[model samples]
Target: MTMPDINYDILRRVAETASAYRYKDIWITVGPEDGQLVIRVHDAKPTCEDCAIFPIAKVDYGSSPSVEVATIGSESNPVDLLNLEVPAGQMIPAGTYAADAVFWSQSAVEKFMIPYYASVYGDQADVVVQTLLTVLKPAAQDGSEPDPAFAIAHLPGSEYVTLANEGLPHLFLIRQSGRVEGAAKR
Candidate 1:
């Protein structure tokens, strides 16, 4: 069976939103086309010099840590930018966290979403996951699970959706099946 498509938008939001909530002066940019993630200080460069912006923790769902799937490296500090990119002459893995719970059960979307957002960026990060599940599950849609393929789309709906839709520009999911395919649009 095919795994669900990982939503770069959600991941980007998790990293950036959380950072913004914590560090309001940081700026983030996603460039999947260039296969890079650039982060820089907004209007605070040259002062802190060593100031660098990075995801405290990415929302990768895989059981293991990130492999060479991308050029997994830190952009040196004191530069105008921090770049996360797929390194040249390296092989990238196929597994990264998408909205696993969202893909599994559409009904659980809200339940999974609230806390996920909280953990990633919302002010409710301190809220217990168990409690969030309890409150959100009861109100979530039931029966049919939403398709994961569309998770990347900037769908129409609530304020949360609108916010989530605004994430790293041009980030994307890379599905895998044995060998690497040339970079193609999903």
Candidate 2:
């Protein structure tokens, strides 16, 4: 199958826009069109912690970084970010407790987000990456899948994704009650 023609500069521009304006709840996805890549970024109003945020891509397992850039875009409504509320409280006793969780894995973030953030933030890119990592899961020294903290520090912006969209979009509908859509499965 052939791909679409993508305007890569657009992706870079969008990333620059996010950084300049400090948009929050940013959701980015990449697709192919006419032999090119079509990138989508769900833009949303900055969160309360708007002052700080997150990145895109700089990925590799055992390969050199590619020069390919994608065309980034947005739907009618973009995305909103969710942050962890560091509650002021006493320390809790350490004990084993089973729990459930759902999050974009650390490797996922690195493969998808790090490059984007690194594009703008340079060496300090991991700061926001770490932020999103916390919400998605836990931090790790090796920078692979995070150690599950059994909590979601961040989540999709429910406002733009569900309510504002006016219906069940494929993006959000893919996950229902912990069962990912068949297409999402390997």
Best candidate, lDDT:
2
lDDT against the true structure, each candidate:
0.29, 0.32
Q: Which segments of model 2 are wrong by more than 4 Å?
A: 1-15, 18-103, 138-186
- Which regions of candidate 1 are displaced past 4 Å? 1-50, 53-104, 123-165, 168-186
Worst 10 residues of 1 by lDDT: 152-161
Model 1's alpha-carbon lDDT is: 0.29
What does candidate 2's lDDT look like per residue over 16-50, in tens digits? 43432232345444444344343344454323211
Per-residue error at 110 for model 2, in Å? 2.1
Give the range where candidate 2 is weakest over 10 consecutive residues by summed lDDT. Answer: 90-99
Residue 88 Cα positional deviation in candidate 1, in Å, after optimal superposition: 17
